[model samples]
Target chain A: MGKILQKPTGFYDKFVRKPGTYDQVTHYCPGCGHGRIHKLIAEAMQNLEIGDQTVFISPVGCSVFAYYYFDCGNIQSAHGRAPAVGTGVARSNPHAITISYQGDGDLGAIGTSEIIHAANRGERMTIIFVNNGIYGMTGGQMAPTTLPGQITSTTPYGRDAATTGLPMKMCEIISQLDAPVYVERTAVTDAKGIMKTKRAITKALKSQKEGYGFSFVEILSACPIGWKMSANDSIKRIEEEMIPYFPLKTFKDEIADRTPRPVVPVAPSQEDVLKALGHDQKEEILFKNDKKFIDDFTTQKVRIAGFGGQGVLMAGTTLGMLGMELGLDVTWLPSYGPEMRGGTANCHVVLSNKEVGSPVVESPNVLIAMNEPSLVEFEPSVTPGGLVIVNSSVVVGKCKRSDVTVLEIPMTEIADSCGLKAAANMASISAYLAFSKVIEKDQLVTLIKAKFKKKSLIEQNVAVIEAAYKYVSDHVRG
Target chain B: MTNDDKDIPRVEIIPEECKGCELCVTQCPKDCLYMSDKINQFGYNVACYTGESCTGCGICFYACPEPGTIKVFKK
Candidate 1:
């Protein structure tokens, strides 16, 4: 009797659960290459002693039961999302070895975009792609890797390149990308072929274990039952048919080894966080106590809408910044039209004493409409007792809703008079704050002073904002 | 009696683990291994040893797709 090699310690001795219970057996069909590939992967992980630290992400299609086999951390991802899931696991657990195992149907079709983006980012992970050239899970269907004359359930008349396009050469396509440290394609049909696959799996896993960036090992496997061929014939077909189109290759081996980046010595402090983000840099210099503070309000939903060049979003941001300074929760959500729009821009601002759920203000308590369309669109959604501040210069129509308090201020005209027409957003914000008393006048002036860093514009902008305060007080208060 | 402990290769096939793909049958240079009509518990016809001529080059051990299915002991 010869010595027996026990199953790789990385695998559970038995797959006991499900439709059947079997010890030391996989659910793969006869002549299917998944079993052989699994053996190679487990051997590599065991050799590297990374099973405990490895997280396997399995997508849809065959091999989705990866958690049932490899005795490691396993996550079942959506159809095309294994790579994305692997990225999250790798980034969060920097010491962990992440593996994304996928079938051709899952990766080549629905997951094409995700794989491309993940490879572009060079997430530290190993991707094992099993290409059997047909969709195995949902019955043999036309896959992106299905050959030209190959007939599947979908392509019953054989694949037409004109109608369905040619089979994607994924290994060659992925190798063209710059980030992957290693890109290879190996088969498992013959003894020599299986040996090649084993070596390729080992190297791919080693790349991840050494903290190398993305490495991919794609295996051209066979599906005898689906191909309607005998086990021997199926193995032969890979050598005769598949090898011609997808030549066994190592498209990349090792990149110019990158110098390991030095670890960060110290965590940045709270002060550093504020300084780097340019937030709260100028300390608690409050608005002057010249105006009354609104202590009664718990939450304020403000929507500012205007034309693209009107700086409408900045007006909402100033309020958002003020909410942060006041130790209140705030969110600023901007809505910019498409690049070709050359149209309108809007922002939704939510300021609250407690946690805010949705940043979108569906029915706002305040609507600052700077143009005719904005007033026409948002005037109906304002709360009955809420404020509707309109820039009378550009917005010609009046607010037909008499339930809300509508204040028509010639903000654009006033900014033009001040020779700072671009300062209309700041002027409008200052006027709204002056009337609402959410923040005092001096604090508003302090924020303007602290926010604008330009020498000439600081004074120029502050003058326009103060004029807004004076205009609101004389016209509305009188 | 002095030749009792000979340094010859002894090959073993875990009958239960063999998928009966016959990769070993094709790879064995000495033509000592063949597929038998007998089926193992996994329901596939298993590979059998001829017990006649095996140089034990370890080709079958390498060729068997299932890990640990074949082993060559030189003792």
Candidate 2:
């Protein structure tokens, strides 16, 4: 038997690392804002009492290992994918206080789509965007936040507005969105700047604890190495140059109050938790026949892969939740990579009566690859006698293996024709379901509408799903 | 937790370092830290040290800027 060591008490005490523990001795240059921002965020988490219920998403950059200092459940995102992953985390675990930390290059460049959409959708999470005016991690490169006339490796002779667009104001952009409850731009140039930064960081965190949707804090930080200046000079630049352009102020704060909601205590003996799990948790369940999938099938692994913004994960999760509603064992595992923002994303769904052996599917029985790249990437792994569905717009070739059946459907064209481009992802997923002959149309339609609460979206998605079902029935000749 | 019981830690504000952002004064769990009438070498009206009651939680240190400006030692 292994040794049973004694661990520490509550998460608070256990998480409090060392005196100078600032999230793995951050990769920031001397006098850089990353360390200060990290400390302030950690402190805010501590003060909010949401430390235990917090899950941080750190984008790939200098501070990728923000988890080391955060002392919480951390999801290290592929470069620029923090917002997408944070969206999933926040949506799945509504109780968790989700935080996404991204550099200017990560957030403003590759992650622009995810950040904008998440802010537009009003996800209840906190975003601490570190805008140091240049890409510090990747050898002092030009970033989206690089100011005019600011020289870097990418912009050697100083940025010219004629050549490069104006330095983006992310807080201003985010403030335009109605969903975000709070958006602020602050700096850490001087002692006073640090004070304002602390307040902004703390306020943004508090908004998340209060269930306010999408709080964003853009922190103008120092980049000593990238700015080609000494530590002291960088601070001076932040005061003299950075602050004038990115003024420190609250862009938007829609929250009625910043205080956290009081947790209502319950006497344990009085209420039934089982009933809450079974009956009170209302969600749509998808299954065929009177018997639930969990009670019938031993196991089922579903893989759905597609380009970014195609609702691939959403479709898989919606189906997974349907399985849950049918009292079937279900798990929705997301395939995350750097291609989250307008590139590609995927999810694996498992439905089973017994416990699943492995979540990773080297040879998935059912595969839905939206793009040509995804098919090329995942096609070799489809098991013989399995079904493979590819998006028609991208996939045009035949497979090498004849044992597996490949069903090509014009998902994008169909969705566009149906006046629902977003439904293309749903269409591909429905095609897989149709070919598999698992879970009938009526039940799936019911589940889809329930998952897609919007009436118009439900109508369009249902049409898209039905069209895919019809296409699968007509096409795929043996 | 009341201010009357004087067992809290004392807060020291280094005027030269304090930018007068009021983060400490505003964020104090107990509204004890305040600006003093006296001025420091920086010529800015700095925050005064109030030792009546304090919690040695080092929250002020976490918030303060000057590396050693705000120190909290137990009695």
Candidate 3:
């Protein structure tokens, strides 16, 4: 019998995603270690029969286009976020063999938090970290794994350990955590080293397949072009210079003694999720048939603007809640500045019979201006035939437009008389209900009673709403 | 020799896919691989088999970086 060893099934036959005319060869430079490591991982995936269930997360760097080669499910993550993304993939699909392929510049520098937390949480994934001592894709700048006294573009005069600190030993750092099942540091400088690296990668992937918690393998790779050396010279550097600082050995191996992690529980049902979120379907039914006055207001885009302390956002929320109670589609978006009390704040409320397209109300059909600055700022954006409700207690200017109907109500003065000046937002909502005849004033009062927690404040807010409704009916509506 | 050639261990190297890195040539234990004087479409000399001392150890297959460049058959 004859045995043929060829390209593994994990790699695509034709790299269709690779740009230019080349389809068979990779974009890696001659004798680049990334290609060797990739071949080893691909062979492992094929031999383990897990290629069909794998999800390879390609990181930013020279291997950013790794998705073009690996035939399994591929997701190109942001710079240094492959571990975090792999966590999501592994957790969501527990049967998936998730692999996070990263580089030194990505994992050692910006993605340190992501890798540390993922390993600490014992995520079921395999991380193949390629450490080339310098940034390969970004033109050979000094990296977190760069050795001391190494000359890079950024470190022109040999890296000074006093200023730049020392090269990070990632395998040592990751093995210190209690969660990871296996951690090894290997190289790809020679045939023996390559075989060792292949075995380490295979072990890491096999542990992941058996649900044996997190596994990480740091491969000391060579960057011939990035290091400005011949391919053979680069391999020599990895053997003589890199191996002395970053030694090659298995740092942690708990695969033989550790038990398989428990399977994740299934997600909750939709009804149970709704119940957990405090949604009551029976209350929605109570107001669904109360469409008697729903036809009075047709699709109103309301804008509420005032100082930050004036409860402008609270007014918009009340309007949105009222629309939802009426069984209409609604959306509310609030915009505010840094200062909590004095800065400007505004909110947009969309109430529609059909599904609302966008929540933003660029040209509002109704404007509730609680201060003079708010009136001056948002008055021009109101539709011509809309209604304007001005809080006459604070607004000094009169409504200059003649096309739209304007209501001048002393909302703060009315609330102050009722002993709670903060209840002006309640007065504003009641005035709109009374003037538009959209819903009964008692509907808003019931909502207020249900919303407010304090007994004394509930009574005071109800009094303000009743007084404002009467004031609008007796003076403004007349 | 012609009849025994069918059972002898051998390797096949694709010319276009080879990057002339000489990794397989240098790493082969039997010294059966060599870089040709001619170049392929990418203007780099490709590796070839000497076809005499063949052990079929498959070390060359692991040393080469590009996928589908080397295929080893053992008898």
Per-residue alpha-carbon lDDT of candidate 1 for residues A1-478, written as tens digits (9 for 90 to 100): 3443445767776676586555656666766777778877887889999999999998897788878888899999999899999988977777889999999998999899989888888788889999989998788999999999889999989999899999998888888888888899999876678789889999888877776888899999988878888767888899999889889989987645753222232456888889888884566545433212334445889999999889898889888987776667899999978742358999999998778999999999989999999999998899899999999988888999989998888888778778889888988888888888877777667776776566688776888888899999899987
Q: Output per-candidate TM-scores for chain A, rounded to 2 decimals.
A: 0.83, 0.53, 0.84
Task: List clashing residue pairs in candidate 2.
Answer: A23-A69, A286-A322, B8-B54, B9-B54
Rank all candidate structures by their lDDT, best first, as comma-separated numbers.
3, 1, 2
Over 4 Å off in model 2, which ranges?
A1-27, A257-478, B1-75
Better of 1 and 3 by DockQ: 3
Interface RMSD after interface superposition, each candidate: 3.8, 13.0, 1.3
Docking class of 3: medium
Residue B3's lDDT within candidate 1 is 30
Instruction: Give the runs in model 1 whose Cα sits over 4 Å from its true position.
Output: A1-3, A16-20, A48-55, A71-99, A113-126, A175-183, A203-215, A249-276, A279-295, A338-342, A416-419, A453-456, A460-462, B1-75
Against the native complex, each candidate's DockQ, computed on alpha carbons, is 0.27, 0.05, 0.69
- Which candidate do you rate higher for TM-score, 1 or 3? 3
User: Largest lDDT belongs to which candidate?
Assistant: 3
Q: Which of candidates 1 and 2 reaches a greater DockQ? A: 1
| Winner by DockQ | 3
Ten-residue stretch with the least lDDT total in model 1 chain A: A258-267
Q: After superposition, how far is residue A258 of candidate 1 from its true place, in Å?
A: 9.6
Quick one: ranking by DockQ, best first? 3, 1, 2
Which portions of model 3 show Cα errors greater than 4 Å?
A18-23, A158-165, A286-301, A305-311, A327-329, A336-346, A352-408, A416-422, A436-463, B1-3
